[model samples]
Target chain A: MKKVMLLIILIMMAIVFTACGGENESSSASENEVSIWVHTSDETPEGEAMQSTIDRFNEENEGTYSAKIEFIPRSGAGGGYEDKINAALTTDTLPDVITLDGPNTAAYAEAGMIAPIGDYITNKDDLLPSIIQQGTYDDQLYAVGYSESGVGIFYNKQMLEDAGIDLSTLPTVDQPWDWNQFMELSETLVNTYDTAAIDMAFDDKSEWLMYAFSPFLWSQGGNLVSEDGSTAEGHFNDENSVKAFSFIQEMVKEGYTTITPVEKGFHTGEYPMKFGGSWTIAEMEDYPDVEYGVMPYPTSPDTNELVSPSGSWQYAMASSSEKQEAAGALIDFMTSTESLTEVTLANSVLPAAHSVVEEVQDKVSPQMNVLIQQNQKSAHARPVLPNYPQVSRVFQQAVSDAAYYEENSDVQELLDDKTGQMEKALK
Target chain B: MNTNKRETLAAYSFLAPALILLGTFLVIPALMAIYYAFTDYYLLTPDQRQFVGLQNFIEIFKDPIFIQSLKNIVLFVAFVIPIQVGAALGLALLINKPRKGNIFFKVAYFSPVVLSLVVISVLWLYLLNPSEGLINSLLANIGIEAQPFLSSPKQAMLTIVFVSAWQGAGYQMLIFLAGLQNIPSTVYEAGKIDGVNKWQNFFYITLPLLKPTSVLIMITTLISAFKLIIQPMVMTQGGPMNSTMTPVYYIYQSGFSDRMIGYSSAMTVIFGIIIGIVTLLQSRLTKEDDI
Candidate 1:
């Protein structure tokens, strides 16, 4: 009996070893196939478009080089995709092709987790300058994006009419409203409508704060980090940045804006105007009764430079992938002009390639046209540095503090505190 | 082989699988966490790490946010434990005997315990919104001013504590109920023969008999309360002004979001030691009481 039991144990161990070895053999056999990881599942429109593009690539390539896609859920308790990606980075389980938020390109590249794909991009020159800027780290292109995103002020046409402001006379993108004029318009709208003049989405205490509000700092001739990307002391807490934040505080204190607004305030017609992104145009389609118009982000009164927030998700290559050629082929196909136009239109965002934008300019809605114009003229990408995530967090906290400012609150003091935090993180 | 030796061999064979699983999952990870605490390891580049000794620990001491998180969790534990335990004991006493509505009451009280913490937090967030919320709408109907329950820095932590206590009290109540049922009814009968009132019997008999149960509840609740993260994270995002930032939330942010694995591991080691010491002291004290 003991001999029989020992023989059975040996057989079981052999079976287990065979099963494990089978997995490795199958994976090596399919080495020509590339895998892509995306944030959204295939149920969404953008995800469907991406899958379609991948399917096309697979059909055309056949056995030469096929591609597969995996979707990670974008929302959860522990930071969702960001947390998963970080965990995957440590485990070296990253896919050959990965999509990351625009600002993460620099951090991923700096950590040597992703490889530079500049040479693999076929239409690098045709891509939007802002897209190129967002994907570049240390003068090398580490990622490529199919769609670009831009933000501007979306206003209610009826509210403007009630406030006796002529829509036709409103400043164009070439000559946008300055800070003083913007404030005057806001006051007029609030007084006439007896509601919030603008919804700045202060309740969204996430990356939205940095993405939507950084334009004001840039328009005022300040930045989150120095040009050399070494420090944030002078640039982040400078006089211009302080003034920009003070304007936000003053707007809240003067009742020109609501700090904690109901979500989708503009769509619900609770606010006359809101600082919104290109995605807002798609969302507004659900509220057909609410007629709206789009305008550029306001310029700083002191500088008169037009600045709008711009950046979007980009495709990257993992450094550990042995299938670089197949991965590059998949990326090239997905970011081609036709694919970009299809994905952008399906996703209801701006296209990253200039040629795609021009092709779809007439086909898109008027609001999309305004977004395209802004992207073409004045979109400025956020700071692309390895420490951008930490810097953005400190700036978000400062903005949140300033939004809750009291009578004796000082914007300069808040900025200085944030500057200290950012400097420490940089170290 | 002899019968005693064969029995010992059988016992060792029976325990092997469980021991292997525990060592792999729990013991190995804990040892790794301690080792990682002495290094400067970022999550994004785990292969590249440098020894930093006690630098992370020293830095955490000077880090204002970490200090604030410590204060926040201590305050949470101080507020949550008593309220949760007292509420649980009260419910257990009410339903100790066979009452007409006992089943309904038990189910109603324990419903929130079954719900996920994220769901409860989200439900409470909508209910506690400053404007256009069920709670505020009710307040408006009664001519009371709207309260910024989660938005206000002064009220956010207290609101989280109340919600957490409400959701957790039911589990403790069930434990207390089981303990209460185990007590001899003859003791209560003896108290009644002595002309002892209900309150007197509760204080002298029930309370004294429930000492072990209370110690168990206290230690478990204290340990769980120190790990407060979900409520504040879902509701407030540790905001308004970092008023609701707890140590566990800070650790998660540092380890996962910020990728500062070494700093986060150092915090975990320190927090683990504190929890271990507290648990040890409580067990010792309770054993002495039993003796």
Candidate 2:
């Protein structure tokens, strides 16, 4: 009995010792340490390059400020990171500096989770104007874009040439093809070559399909949610979007975009033109035999304006950070052109800062610059609302189901059910 | 008298740790589950609960999805337990006959019991993947069209059951092996001398002696089958319109994903009661043969 009591006491002592020991060790470095939350490209060569730079910074500025990097793995489209940030906020253990962007930066900044970065943006000329627009949310720079991505048309040049489609006379960046012309080219390529569907993945979570397709929904006179962003608009059932949805479906039905069984689909090269982002360039680099070209997403047949969904992951400061100064320093260092260029090179996207783009222009592939330009011209982001996740989830499930069961499924019914559920979830 | 009193106190003190452990770990949690079954608790946002009355129960009943899962659970238990236990018993009986490499056969039959559930699930997932799997390739050779093993609603639940039975049959085989060892050789020798053939001798001799072992195997197998969560989770994720969704999976989904701790507690309580009732019925049905 005495032994058991003594053992319990020893265990308690050990826990206390460990916790206190942690405090004691950190106290020495806390003055010099910058605890920054790093998201994206932490595993690639370019990510390695950024880490090496930080290592150099820490070694050189050892007495001034030590770099304490905290990496969160959120590689694919940066969808699940918001829930984690929310969880961190509730626990009061947020990092000194965290990364977020697009709807994410907007949502959290509104919630007062991220600190303002206006004081940190003295080097404004060092950043891109469009990227600067994304970083500055609600009149204050809450986050700096780590990398920029724009959804656009990525066509297999070999597939087009084999289909006997003349490519030298193909529409250039300045002379962009309209939706009707794009459709004609796509249908001809598929039919003439007898190839598979358009290269695209149907993800209901990120709804990045919105990037490739939803811009047209807007251009053809539709909105995802109501103007105030208080309600979902049931756009698939709306007259304009219904026609747009049918146009996309006709691509499938008319043999231009066959229903490629999930396996024999785009990523496998069974398809020709992929409506995707800059990352598509990185993915296609492995297929050296397959030559591809990049352009803006097709303009709407009616609107005559090229549209793409613009979003980027950014770095932010957590409200609960104890080492605020160090964290801010890390964020500042990471957002600098040197680090931004490394991130862009790794991710196959545009540099987050203008200076970085100018510095690393030769380093990045030519295919990727088209995406950067596309993002600069036109890309809209999802509405940054607290209830946006729930709204998106409900909308995506309905739309995907609508696409699958085009006839039997009622888009209005699904919209009504999910909207009600969204309202309940918000409450 | 004082010394006697001190000894008595010491005896009670010795029992204190065990009593505290059982009460804290088992009894208290059970009671808390029952309490929370009547409330609506979002685990992520604690300090907020509403007295829901019988609302959770009503929701469970009204939810077609929940009802279907319950029915599926029962069907799985009914079908899997018999086949698995019977196969184990037959295998045990075969190995009981003294032959060359009898121990090797016994060990070979029981090898799968040593494998972890996750390892087994992964192995089966690759083997069961319809497009590029061993099972489908073999089926194609027989001039059969590739069957949607995990993807189709028609085949998913059954595929999970089949995989589970294959993995779990070995554990029950050990129990049956022990039971076979307990049977007397004298009765079998007498049966051989009497003109009773192998089938009659086995049914008449082996069946009665193995009653207790059968009962034990059945009860344990049913409990395990009823708590089916891993196979469906790793393989199907309870999809194709949620045909493979189990009660325990529902409980996890409610507790962690939905953060509806109160609803999950209600489910846990109900599942506990169901298990208790099943155990009671099993004992009652089998207790008569014991005497």
Candidate 3:
């Protein structure tokens, strides 16, 4: 009986050991296979464009390399695709090329999960400056964005006209209205409508807070971090940042916006305006009653400098993969002018490269044209920091806290406290 | 070759598969987590990890968000256990007597339990929306103002508590129902012979007899409450101001979102210790009652 028990234990141990040891030993044993992972399902237009791009790459490279694509769509809470990537990181089973969000460029590069691909990119200058900015970390380009994104103030044309405001007198992307002008317009709309003036999506207590609202800080000559992305103390807590924060607080205090806005409030014309991105254009099609037009971001009163947020999923090479040249060629092909045009048009997203910008200019809608112009002129990528996730969370909290700002809610103090938290994340 | 040896061999053979699975999946990962708790094991840079001793532990204590998460979870468990267990008891008692449509009532009560938590949470999110939700519209019909149930930090945890109880109590009610059924009718007949009234019979007989079932339900509810994540994740993303953040949710965020696996592991260890102490106290008290 004792011998039998010992034998059973040994067999179990052998099974466990063999199971653990069964991981593939050679990543590049099949040298021609170039695996690519994207963060959208194949059913989506963006995924279809990605598949076509890979098909083109494979056809062009033919026998030397065979590019394959896998779509892993992200969940609503932003997990599925990233969860797979994180798991793959530990198992050494990461694909040759992977799609990452733009802000993660610094973190992935710093952790050595992705390799620098500056030497691999063929048309570096043709890419939009914001795309380059979003993909660079510590002076090295680690990734290349395949598309760009833009946020603008989307308004109900009927509501503004009913409020006796002339549409043409409104600020254009070339010369946008300042914060004061925006607020005045909001107050008029609110009084006329007897409801909240705009939906800032304060209810979306996620990365949207940081992504959509950070440009407000930038427009005020304030930044979440310093130029080199080293620190957040003076920059995040500066007077300019406080001014931008107070502007948001005032909007909340005056009932121009609500922390808990009705779902699709702007879509249903419950609000006169919304601080929405280019994606809202497609969603607006569902509501034909609300005639809407895109407007540039309301600039800070001090600088009157226009700055809008820009970022999207970008392609990066996985460090674990030995097929660096093949992966690089695929990435270059995916971000090429023709590929970019196809993707931007198919997905109805902004063009990442200047050449594609011209290719897509006349093809997209007039509202999209406004966003494209904004992207070309004033789009700013978020700070490229290795601790961007933590920092962004703190920034999001600051915006949330300020939105509930009362008389006791000193904007400076709130920013100062948040800056401390940002400092901790930076360390 | 005796009977004793043969029986022992049979028992060992039956237990082998389960033991191997437990060791491979649960025990190994738990051991790995404890080991990583002492290191700076960033998820993306696993190979570059370095031993950092109690640094991660110390940092977690210093983190205000971590402290707030701990407080939120404790509060959630404190409220959810009693409310959920009590609701289950009430429901069990209501359905204990056999009557018309008993099966229909049972299924209706158990329906939420069978549905996915994510679906329930999303449904509740829309229903509790401040302005456009059905709940607020109902409130408005009575001339009451719309409430920011999930968006307000002051009310978010309590709102989650009620929601959790609504979704979870049904399963516990089924357990209580079985426990109720196990109580023989003769005991109630004896109570009736002693001239006890309806409320009196319930208090003197049903209450004391249901002790074991109630204890089991309370313990399970307590533990599940401490593991709160999905509701907050789906509904609020752990904030209008991190009011609904729980320790488990924060641990997940640190490990996956921030890639600070070591810090998350440290939090897990600490959370496990806290749970261990609570369960130990509970068992000790329950044992005393048994004695």
Candidate 4:
């Protein structure tokens, strides 16, 4: 019996060893073949559009060059997909063409994980300024986006009308609502509607905080980091930055905005207004009964300056890729005016290319035109620094603290704490 | 001599596969973590890591977030172990008989254990929502004001502890049930003959017999409590104001989100040492109880 058991165990060990030793043979791509890794799966319209683009690229090149895509799921722990990309970088297994969040471009470029595509991209000047700003690192173009994203105030039209607020009198991009008027409107709407005035999506304690609210800081003439990008002390803790955050703290304190709101507060009519992204346009279509309109971010009460958050996912070439030329070709084809129009239409996003925006101007809804105009005029890319991930996190936490403050809670102190954290991280 | 050698070889063959797996997955990575903890290894620039000696460890003590995380986890362990172990014991005692509905009770008690922690956390997040969640809605129905169970900084950690204890008690209950069954019915009958009442029998006989089982449950629950990450990460994101930031979640944030692999590794090393010391102390106490 002992001999039989020992023999069985030995056979099991052999099988295990064999299984462990089996190497995954890399699919032998021809010299002309280039592989891409995209975050979106083929289930969505955007993913399908991307796939169709790749298929068209392959068909056009025929035997000259081919592009294939491997879909990577972006959902998981906060940085799960980025972690996968980082692992691939370490193992020298990164795909030739890679799509990454625009804000990550600086970090990837600094780490030498992505190569600059300025020499390959001819239509750099045609791309929207915000897109160009987001994709550039050290004054070099490292990535290019096909579509841009912007956030604006989405107000319930019926609720606003019921509150006796005239739609025509509302702020426009050229003459946006000053911070004081915006707060007064929010207060009036809350009393009239008997619901939360605005949904700033405090529950989404991630990149959303920095993306949607940083415009307030910028419009107030404050910046996340200095021009040198070496320090955040004077810049993040500046008078304007403190004032900008104070507005948010006051809103939360007075119950104008909720620190913990239902996920779809505007769609469900739980709130009169929402500081929502362009993606909300698609979501609003689901609720046709609830009429809504988009307005530019409210201007700073002190400066009357208008700024809107901008930047979205962009494609780049991996530094380790041997087929850089072919990868660059894939990126160029994807971000072309024609491709941008198709993708922007399919995804219901603002087109990155200036020509695409102009060509599709009359075709899209009036609400979309608002986003397009903002993307062109008022959009400001998030701080394009290598330490952006850290900067965004510290700022997000500080904002959360201020928003969830109780009595005696200090907004300036929170901001100063974040400033210190950012300084330490930059070291 | 040849026969003995052959027997030893056969035993060694039987152990090879498990040993190899352990060495590859757990032992090697643990050693690597120790080595990396002494470096400045950023996840993005893995090859550019340089030795920083005790700098990372020294910094960890000074990091307010890390200190807060340490305090939070210690509090979590302190509250969760007793509550969970007690709940498990209560449930085990209630269902350790041959009653008609005992099987049903066992399944009901253990259901939460089978559910994934993420699913449980998400479900509780919805149930605990202050405005429109099921719990608050029910509270409103009862003419009671809604409680901000998760949103309040004061209540968030305690709420998480209660939810974690509720979810985890069932697994430990099964172990306690086994310990209960091992105590012979004859022992109880003997106590009954001596005119000992039910409560007296339980206090004198059942309580002493359960010491080993209690120690085992305490050690396991303590270890698991110290590793609390998923609940806070999914439910709170360690906020209202970093009130629920456990050591493990902080380690995860440092390693993955912040990409500070070396600093995170140092934290993991410290956390591992703490867990090790706790386990050793628990075993030693249990052994002394046996003596």
Candidate 5:
């Protein structure tokens, strides 16, 4: 009984604390105060660096609106920040500024929960085109990014060297591998030393597998969202997508890739090359003995454009915000070159602002520049539809079903069925 | 002199707060959800909401993904109940043996019951991770091939059922334990004197007496197991091919992921109706006289 009462009291206190707006800025006569919430787990050094940046912003602002940042830390394995945001929305209280992912930004923006910040970012000439493209929701920008990450081929150089693969004449970004080049290399590299060229975990259950398989779809010009972003077209079962899928299927069949159920292609290091995002750079540095370099995801043989599945995070204002000035100012402070540089070095991602990119590149690991160069012509947000998370999930399941089907299936019919469901979901 | 009027007022006052809370949070939302299910409601974009009467339900029933999710849930309920119930019975039978350390054994087995679902899921995830996990290591030591417990579509559902049974059997075990203690020792002794074997005695006497306890455990567990969201959601995320996607998980996916609160609400209504009917059937079958 005492414990229950104590629990209720604790909950009540949390509600009250969450309700507390940062000490109201005492007008121009007093110190202006703004609250910011960074919705990432606290374990990362990047989050810590971000806190330091917030502290610096506070120190610099003095009596003007001093920006105060708080971390809304989450359990790393589930739900993420959607439930936290939902609770905040219900209470009609929100942080002055929030860092959100691209899909979530679209959902919140479409819901009228977020304010359009195109007016703020468009006027700034330093904004990068690809990053800005990702921040737009319903033809209006609601968020501005400081740093960006995109998928790339991170190869273990020592593994390549041991296999007698020459790096001196490696293809430049323009002359990079198409499907033919990729297959030839994947086959030869695997057979030459009997080492796995790529880790292809056949299981659809792993998050890493989903992340790994996405580039194949993107490389073939397939996408998660419809052209208008209102619906999801079943590109997973498309001809080009199937061709790419069949290639991976053949690799699994031929032993060119690591198809082990327990130990996957990359993390097991059975495969020297890993197709992952810039997020891997920080961890890659720990492998000091393994010489490695990052390159753009191979171009589609058909599209001829170097396409990469990129994802970004945005800082924006909540709809119920009464303190728009404070929110806007906080967002502005976070997006500034100083903060962007800190995030770039800490997170090992490419800076969003063009000017900031040039400055921060030298500060971060040298491998991170691959993201910056890749961002120039080959970047994309995964999908920004309100139904994107579900869409990806449903698509992943369909692809997995097709991949693991013991019997033959009508691929087109499967694709048609998924599209029909997506249409209904959009409706 | 005015005792009747004062009594009426007291009754009204006693009911008022509860009525208000129920009306606001429960009863009202339940009605509103039915209405929303017929509309094209988006939680984030309130303006996009428009009435489309029966369209959402049509869309859902016809949806292949939704159909797969439903099929998965049915399989899950069918698989988990037997596994969990059987395990619970076995545990009850074992622990019913009053030995020197029976109390300690009961406490050890029941410790998982007190743990939070999220904590248990995390612990299980680490313990089941194919490469470095303890279970895999133990299996490797025995020369058995490492299994993809949560990563293979064929294995994921069964693995989850096993984990769920492991976590939940203790609660049902306690009820079975009570039922076991209630059986008079004279019946077993009389059966022994009549030349009945131990197995025969259990089959005839113990089984008949434990029917009520079994029924009680079954009904409660059936209702509670339908709410299995936290485990699969946190662990597998209904993945490896929607093998773990239960109806409640689908409800969350639709309402939050798709932002079609109306469609999700329709799903909720359907869910409520299904549960309501199931409960009624269960009660009808397990009436006192029938026992």
Candidate 6:
């Protein structure tokens, strides 16, 4: 009994000592330390480039400030990194700087979790308009996206050829095909293959629904919310939005796309075309047998305006940080033209700045260059709202419910029903 | 101190670690959940929380998605309890007597219980895929058309029920096996002396003796069935028109993904009450059976 009690006491003492040791170590580094939390594993090329950028920043700012980076990888359903950030918001243990998704700028800024770093950026004019638009909330730049992302129609060259489609007549960023023409091509492919013509990642059933499919709504002259980001009722359920929803529903109804696509159908050559983003470039490297090419988004038949989704992870200064200047410096350094080019080239992502685009234009693959071109010409960022997640979820469910193609499945009614849900979130 | 007091102190000291862990991880969080249910606590703006009495609870009851989730969970629990418990008892009976290569059958039946639920869900997702899955190919060979297992809202909840039961019945089977072993052989011997056949012996003796174990399994399985989240989260993501959305999954989505902590807490509290009532009802009925 005595020995057991002594053992317990020793264990307790050891735990106390370890806890104190950890606090002492952190405090020692707290004087000039600028901690950063990123949303990727360290082993990835993007994470390595981020670390090198931080190391360079630390070297230049040596005795004045030191920056430390922590990588918190997100899971498939967008949990780990965001979960840590949410927990830290309550506990007040957030790092000096943290990485957040682009659409979250409004939420974070409105909640006072992130500070505006617009004045910190040295070359703000050099950043792409879409990146600036994505990072800005209420006319203040709360976050700066390091890399831009854009979705495009990825088509299998062989399948298109087999379906008797002309290669030279395909859409380009400058002169994109209209939705009617795109559907005609989808019809041909479906008739030839006797299967779903495209994989729009409908099976993902998450943010991808809004991210990849919202372009259609935008091209049709519909907005998820008003320009003021105040309401989603008339805009989300308006005629233009209904046209976009029905267009999506038509594809599923006509057997041009499916709600449940085969996993990696495009990569495996099971589907002729895929609605894919810039990240799909890296993913396509594994599929050596399939030769693919990128095409700009199909414009709406009525408006003929091209639009594509744009948003990626961005860096922001945490509101809890006392050393705001140092945090701002780190954010500035990481999003500098050179750092952006390095990160973009390493991750195979679209460039966030014009200078980085010029630097990586010749180096990146032609497929990626096509996406970059579309991004510059036609990218539209998602709606920036404090309750963007709920709004996006409602939009996602609307897409899913509409695409199921049952009797009495009124697209307008579905949109109106979903609009009510979005309105609740917006409120 | 007296010897008795010292012993009691030592016993408490031994339990200190587990008690502290439970208090920190479970008890405090539960208490916090109850308190947060009455407030408007958004996840991002935690410090800006406000106490709005019964607002969250009232709002959740009105929310169509929450009501749909409640309906789905109840349907799941209603189907899963009997299917899972029946399969467990069937397996327990199959392995009760020693047979050739019995260990292999036991291991095979118990293997899925040890595997992670996420892995099982993913594997089943591929197997249940409408077109390219192995199950479809096998069905094709048998001249049965491919079924849209997870894609059809009408079929998704039932499909999940089967997958969950297949994955969960092994552990319950082990418990039933123990209960079977605890049944005295002398009782069976006396039944044999009374000229009772095997069927009569099982129906009259084995079943009557297994009531306590069956009741225990039913209560546990009932509680777990109410907490179905992982399978839907991994498989369908509460989709195909929210056909498989369980209450727990909706609560997680509300709190973590949608960042509506107050609403989610209200949901958790309501779900807890429902479970408590159902469990009480089950136990009351079982007690009457004993009487």
Taking the candidates in order, what DockQ does each have? 0.56, 0.12, 0.65, 0.53, 0.34, 0.66
Tell me the tens digit of each residue's lDDT in model 1 across B1-291.
699999999999999999999999999999999999999998888889999999999998899998898888888888999999999999999988797989999999889999999999989978887767898999999999999887778888988999999999999999999999988899989888999987898899999988888888989998999889999888888987888999999998888768788999999998898888878987888788682
Question: Which candidate, 4 or 5, has the higher lDDT?
Answer: 4
**For model 1, how does the per-residue alpha-carbon lDDT over A90-193 read when each residue is reduced to its tens digit?**
77798999999888888899999999998888999899888889999999999997788888889999979977999998877999988889999998988887
* TM agreement with the true structure for every prediction: 0.92, 0.74, 0.94, 0.93, 0.83, 0.94
Q: Is the docking of candidate 5 incorrect, acceptable, medium or high quality?
A: acceptable
* Superposed Cα deviation of residue A190, candidate 1 (Å): 2.5
Q: Clashing residue pairs, candidate 2?
A: A34-A326, A98-A316, A99-A315, A100-A314, A128-A354
- Candidate with top lDDT is 6
State candidate 3's DockQ: 0.65
Instruction: Judge candidate 3 at residue B120 and give its lDDT.
Output: 96
Order the candidates by DockQ, highest first: 6, 3, 1, 4, 5, 2
Question: Using alpha carbons, what is the TM-score of model 6?
Answer: 0.94
Stretches of candidate 6 exceeding 4 Å from the true structure: A1-32
Native contact fraction per model: 0.61, 0.00, 0.94, 0.55, 0.52, 0.77
Q: In model 6, what lDDT does residue A380 have?
A: 87
User: Compared with the real two-chain complex, what DockQ does model 5 have?
Assistant: 0.34
Question: Residue-wise lDDT of candidate 3 within A1-427, one digit each (tens)?
Answer: 9999999999999998877666443334447778999899999999998999888888888878778899999986558999899889878899999999998999999999999999999999999999999999989999999999989889999989999999999999989999899989999998999999999999888888898999999999989888877788999999999999999899999999888888888998889999887789999988988899999999998999999988888999998888899888888888899999999999999999899989999988888999999999999998899998999999998998898775228889888899999999998
lDDT, candidate 2, A1-427, per-residue tens: 9999999999999999999999998787566676666664568665576677678769777788887665666634553554565566657766677766565665566566777776765566766665666666656777777777677777778777888878776765556777678778877876775764365554222355444566667667676666655555454356665655656655655655532233434455667777667666767766777778876767667776766667677777765566666667777777777777776776566666667767767776767777776665665655555444445544444444444444414545544554565554444
Candidate 6, residues A177-220: lDDT per residue as tens digits?
Answer: 99899999999998899999889888998888889899999999
Give the alpha carbon lDDT tens digit for every residue of B176-288 in model 5: 99999999999888888899987987889998889889888888888877767888887787876677888888898788766678889988888888878887898888785
Q: What is the C-alpha lDDT of each candidate?
A: 0.88, 0.70, 0.90, 0.88, 0.72, 0.92
lDDT of 3 by residue, B2-27 (tens): 99999999999999999999999999
Q: Number of clashes in model 4? A: 0
